[model samples]
Target chain A: MKQSAKLNTVNKWWQYETTASQKWFQFGLKDLYYNRGLILRFTRRDLLASYQQTVIGPFWIFLQPLLTALVYLIVFGRFAKMPTDGIPPILFYLAGSTIWSFFFDSLNGTMYTFISNTHIFNKVYFPRLVVPMSIILTQAVRLGIQLVLFALIYVFYYFIFHTASPSKILLLLPLLVLLTAGFAFGLGLLISIITAKYRDLDNILQFFLRLFMFATPVVYPASIIPDKYQALFWLNPLTPIIETFRAAFVENGKIPYYPLAIAGIEIFFLISLGLLLFKKRELDVMDSI
Target chain B: MRELVLKAENISKYYRLGLIGSSSLKQDLQNLFVKSRDGLTVEDPQHIWALKDVDFELHAGEVIGIVGRNGSGKSTLLKILSRIARPTTGSVRWKGKISSLLEIGTGFHAELTGRENIFLNGQILGLSNAEVKTRFDEIVAFSGIERFLDTPVKRYSSGMYVRLAFSVAAHLRSDILIIDEVLAVGDIEFQLKCIAKMKEISRLDGKAILFVSHDMQTIRNLCTTGIYLEKGRIKLIGDPPKAIAGYLNLDTQLSKHTYSSPHEAPGNSYIKIKRAELENSTIIHFEFWYTAEGNENLSIGIMLYNDLGQCVFDLASAPTRMENGLIKGACTLPENFLNEGQYVLSIAFIGDQSKLLFDFADCLNFNVQDNGKNLRWYGKRVGIVRPEFPIQLLNIDRDGAI
Candidate 1:
């Protein structure tokens, strides 16, 4: 059983060095590329395992947004009389809630990356980013399904009811999805890394995301905000993203390019900061966990 | 010359002892303020080094065994090598891809079928989709759970889970493999098969391996070189037998005869030998505390072994009935049953058709000094046991001798 005889002649070597000044913020794109297959596999597992053994299974993905939109239609549209910028209440709320849910689910899912995967992370070494990335991709798939449902509902409202018109700004829909993902991912990663060390932050995060949902234009039109406080509302990065999404679907809704651009810049900064913190903390977070 | 595949230098890791996460934001703020005001770091007092200044080099085909008692930094060293955790200071370099089997079947979802988990686990271990697909048959065959491949892993028995897990880990293709005590799972046959597979991979593919195990026999059987860690430092490094001997010798020196607390004693909740010792080096003295409701067919087995890890004598008590409570038992080995050498005593509590309630190995150690009785015969005894036997001589007629 001696292994000496099987020795090969290859001399290639890879060296790893640990120092106080070690670059922890390299983004590890190469490592991520190397483990891309694992990311896809994890995404599949998350999608499959989420609804496994349940009767409704994948139907729940569509049903969740649909039901939430219905609740908003009855409560905000009828009871509260919230203005939707003259668009049909169902289409307005459906568009806003479906997009909002995608962002919220992505953020929530990424926030649990460290806590939920601590067991696997503690045992194995792959690109740690793959877990969060998989969460984002899985949420993205759910978003895609919900968007198709939104499209079908939009067609029925436009052609059948003749109450809504598709805007040329709808071309920005893909950009809106990308921005939503970036915003959610950046903020989620930041929170996830903080919670790994401070765990108390996790409790605060749920409360914060829930409260922040009201600030976004998911339930009411952005036009309803008083001009004096519109600046304050736009300070929330999600405002511009949600406003732009709604604007692209309705005739009277206006695309706020300046605020959207500001939000986009903020997202880039947030994600960079998030990645920096995540990279620095990931090395030693397992010891703490 | 064999190619150098891996090298680690001055590796050290420090871990905090108390609560891991911050308690609250208010406390964290206060601590930060206090830390800045005093101009002193507060982290030093709360941290202890799990590993310190460990250095090693491995060639392409070397299978090095890391041996130490628990908490001696053997696992910490492996964690550093495997890239699961970065060392606080120091570096490790290796050739080609490295795969770590820190825990077998890591990330195996219970709801996923055995077939799906095979692909998932394989990818997690750095195997590509095509790679897993090609090796799927071999992995399934090795696990011997082909019939249940379509069944969810949750439905698989613990043994089947371990078999499937180990099979996937064993099939991982990499230039270097780092494993920690995972072979302790599964059946003895599977364990041996894993050891053989490790040897074959190292020989045929020239993969370097760093294996950590508390099982000294496996270390002696499979490793080409050994590293003995003690209190976060490398105590000995070289031959496997020598390192294992050093580790065992260190174990005996640290705790001479008695294991004081239940924590120090090795056993499960069912039974534990609270304290064990030797009296006058001849009559073995030991006491065990057992807690079992309706203790029917309960018996104790004691074995004596020499310093070289060879069993010289083994004896078991007859079945005895007892009530539920803290019960103590003492047994004495017959006189002159062992020769003059360092001996380790192991105990096992067996109940109901020899089912093991608890087993503790190397529980107590004692020395025999061989008083002047065999002075003319030896410098040291040749064998493990010196039993007392009767001898007789008879006269025979010369005519009948032919």
Candidate 2:
């Protein structure tokens, strides 16, 4: 039975049309806003579930970066004799690993959004973006805990050796963290869309991300890069954010304001493109996943 | 006039066959570059339309039940309506929010406590913290698991888990709810509670519900309207009774014998139906192979039903001892007693005419032919059973002088 066309009001109705052209870029921003409570609930669940069965529980958040920094200290600082730009090697590695871990954790958490949550996605209707957003939030909370470890180590190294100073660029600390998170969110969203269809991409993505850390100057200072490769190295979006983050606290690394600004623009573009593609693929991904 | 809640037009879904997620990259590239016979980019030969040209409308307070055989697009239609998957073509327009319980406890975390899961499940179903808080006591009370609220759901029994999940879902405040057989879970008492809750919501709250279920009894009890789907299309849509009849008729097969051998027949170890078939004209013949371990006073009962799921007759043979072998039983229907229509027969094994040992429903179906001639009437006679009784014509005299 067809109703009168005049009764078809548009404001309150959710219209699902088949054409890909109309509203292709909606991004479900309003729905995401309305369902923010759902995001919080999911984030809480992830936070609780991650440590529920572990013996030491949430301490793993602080231990992960500490152990990674220690491994880098022995492998790169002592064995390979990589320079830390006149800063204490442990503090240098801690700062780099702490910030880089945030990016890594965020990407790892959000990249499998579609596949891991397909069960729920198949049954319920909410803003699909909430899953990835909640994942990002969970990682951010873990990053906060890791930051406490970073702060404690920085204080110990600063008072004893006077090797680090808070530079004026430290004001940009929040901005730097935001840029790193944005890049991860963008990359994670793109990876999830592709992985939903091609599941084998996950193995390749993990390997590629492992290799990508070498390109971002996470274990070594940016100054160690040879002058000939400097131009090419800056092209990596993460190079600027990582360098800026270390420079803000340690003051030994260069700020690279122009490059940082360029990285910001790049991250903004990447996130927009990620959101558009994610929204487009969200509905169809359910079937393939 | 009731406010229209949902309207779907020409919705269809096409799924590619064979290894969707694991398809080779080479094939994907070829699919992108190659042109089909119609010059379109797509050219997959092995594909099927899971749903095709399905159109329907739901108004406020109307409960519609969807029934279909497996792979008949019932799930695809629900997925499209709930926005879980996009349709291949056409569109759906709906006012108000839709909350679907394609399953109970969809996003429950096993490691999380029941109390936390309640909030998580509630929010996933589109409720806010304030709303969940308002109904928190009601949900807990309905589930009857407040003692285990702080315990992780992994420790809850399967029934408790399902009860908690359904309780949260039942409390969701939405204009439209799409449920897919969630009531089939839990014990019968909880199921009845859920059915009553659904009825109350539709009646008192005026929420529109689109339910998909294979349970005819629940469909008849809960739905105001029904849609029977067949092979990806809407075969019938009307009142619940009519649609259910259509669905049941579509499912009925005219098998002379439901099982070819006694070993494969449907029954327990005590009794099995060896053969059940319609004999010459009106004689219904069946063979039951029963073991000697069964009770001696075992009686066989058969109930006949018409297309509308209404029973026409129920009768049982006298109690008799069954040997450890096949026993022949026959019940002859009096000619011209049954109306000319399709009828389903169900056999029940009873002990001492009191306890039901086993019941097999709609095991065989037969059509009573309308070959009987009635000279007085030219058209068909209507009733559940058409019986001919002796009639004598008498004329009343003018002054009682007959």
* Residue B118 local lDDT, model 2: 96
TM per candidate comes to 0.79, 0.78
For candidate 2, write residues B1-402 as lDDT tens digits.
798888888888888876777865787777666644333335456778888889999999999999876678999899888888888777777777788889999899999999999999999899999999999999999999999999999999999999999999999868999999888889989999999999999999999999998778899999999999988999999998778877667356654665567778878876788777877547777877777455568898988877554578889989886667777888888887877777777789887788677787667777777766755665557787888777898877768863
- As for model 1, its CA RMSD to the true structure in angstroms is 11.4
Query: Lowest summed-lDDT stretch of 10 residues in model 2 chain B?
Result: B35-44
Number of backbone-clashing residue pairs for each candidate, in the order shown: 0, 0
Q: What are the runs in model 1 whose C-alpha is more than 4 Å off?
A: A1-13, A18-21, B22-45, B250-277, B280-364, B367-402
DockQ for each numbered candidate: 0.41, 0.37
lDDT of 1 at B262: 62
Per-residue error for A96 in candidate 2, Å, reads 1.4
Chain A TM-score of each model, in the order shown?
A: 0.92, 0.91
The candidate that wins on DockQ is 1
**What DockQ score does model 2 reach against the true complex?**
0.37
Among these predictions, the greatest TM-score belongs to 1
